[model samples]
Target: MPAFLESERLVLRPVTASDLDDLVALDADPEVMRYLNGGRPTTRESVRRRVLPRLLHEYPCLGTPGFWAAEPRGGGTFLGWFELRPLDDDSPAEVELGYRLNRASWNRGYATEGARALLRKAFTELGVERVTANTMAVNARSRRVLEKAGLLFVRSFTEEWPDRIDGSEHGDVEYALSRGEWLRRHGG
Candidate 1:
């Protein structure tokens, strides 16, 4: 089993066909999808026909890695998923960082640990110039994780969602780190 990247606590690997059940369960959790889809459960048909295909196919396209299945390096428990993929594949330097974790895996610094590892890979190995992440403005927990992972508060903005989540009125916040900024804090 090949891993795309490894942190001290996590082994980040691409989602395979074998990951459907895990992905479905993760998305079905209300807390996990609170900010994403307002806790609306994704139908099994949707997961099978839509979500899994995109996740499965992206590994070949993202090259270095796309979305990853984040599992503990210790006992190999499935924690959740993390992503560091280009917004536009034609320009691979501007990547985005995002994560979704199991409720059981919450508050354990797993998110921060995984995020920092991806940032290190982005700046040092992948030559990414900038990485950005966004979350609902009221998602203080995720905001904190992004900051802890070295992404600074960039701005707050709004997106017109077709079906807005509960906290959308507060808008969304973006956090970011540049290669130079990352090196300044963590050393090159």
Candidate 2:
């Protein structure tokens, strides 16, 4: 499949039905799902019914799927996925940035690389006015990746989570960058 985006060591392509196994494996890892679902393994049925459909749907505002399967540059294992989805179905002004990689791919800079690339695309090619991301406050590693991708801390807020997980008491932190800010920073 042709890549939707590329970085030095990774390629992001539109997610497909063939990626079901990879998604299942990525979501099954306890370490990977620690913050997401308190280490609860997502059943393959859930991946098929809920996750894959969301991943496959092309946002009307963006004219493309918001999620992409991540893989190594020259064809390798599925690393995980990256997302740059519009906040609203009809607007591309604001979008959320996200990534999930298998345990084997963590701490290897793939997340940061993919994130930076997405931010660039959001600001330059996609007509996005703002890019935002958030994670549990306890996820220092994820916060660091957002910072390294050039987003600044916005605010910390708490919401009702159906199933509370570790660090839920600490709330969540939002990070964001505007297109104007990005242009100024990149001299675009």
Candidate 3:
């Protein structure tokens, strides 16, 4: 089945080769890439050769487990993408949830909405045991999104990044929600 998920105002479709341009453009925005790559723009060649190929490879064996391009539901304007991938050495049924939205789309609640929808799908349909997301400690906006989606702060760990941005020393925060926790929160 073609990987497509929908929210009230957004459409989520698997990232394909045709989405290279949109992906590149999204990653090129300095503010968008700030916490990720030290505000450095990604080269189109890298996006095409490496990023696009990786996304395409995930289409088959990954089992609807890759990044999905996010667009406006009615107009199909590219907003950004959401990633739901199984961790290395993990079963397909267990996945990590993530989102990256364009700066223009920030503060509009798209990220939180999309993430909540995915979490719902995972728990209700995919038999997911847990869903987790990570972000820089200083990224209060992202941390808030995860919290709004019902994930609780689990840990803070440091990893070597390519370029330390303005707030790397504080470490990265991990947020997670287990199937039981999700069910409890919903009074199931």
- Predicted structure with the largest TM-score when compared to the true one: 2
lDDT of 2 by residue, 1-188 (tens): 88999889999999999999999999999999998989999999999999999999898999999999999999868999999999997999999999999999999999999999999989989999999999999999999999999999999999999998999999999999999999999998
Per-candidate Cα RMSD to the true structure, in Å, reads 1.5, 0.7, 1.9
Output the better candidate (1/3) by TM-score: 1
Candidate 1 wrong stretches, greater than 4 Å:
59-62
Better of 2 and 3 by lDDT: 2
| Evaluation by lDDT, superior candidate among 1 and 3 | 1
* Candidate 2 lDDT score at position 112: 94
Off by over 4 Å in 2: none
Cα displacement (Å) at residue 27, model 3 = 0.7
The top-ranked prediction according to lDDT is 2
- Report the Cα lDDT for candidate 2: 0.94
- In model 3, residue pairs whose N, Cα or C atoms come closer than 3 Å (at least 3 residues apart or on different chains), thus clashing, are none
Each model's lDDT: 0.87, 0.94, 0.83
Q: Pick the winner on TM-score between candidates 1 and 2.
A: 2
Models ranked on TM-score: 2, 1, 3
Model 3 superposed RMSD (Cα): 1.9
Candidate 2 clashing pairs? none
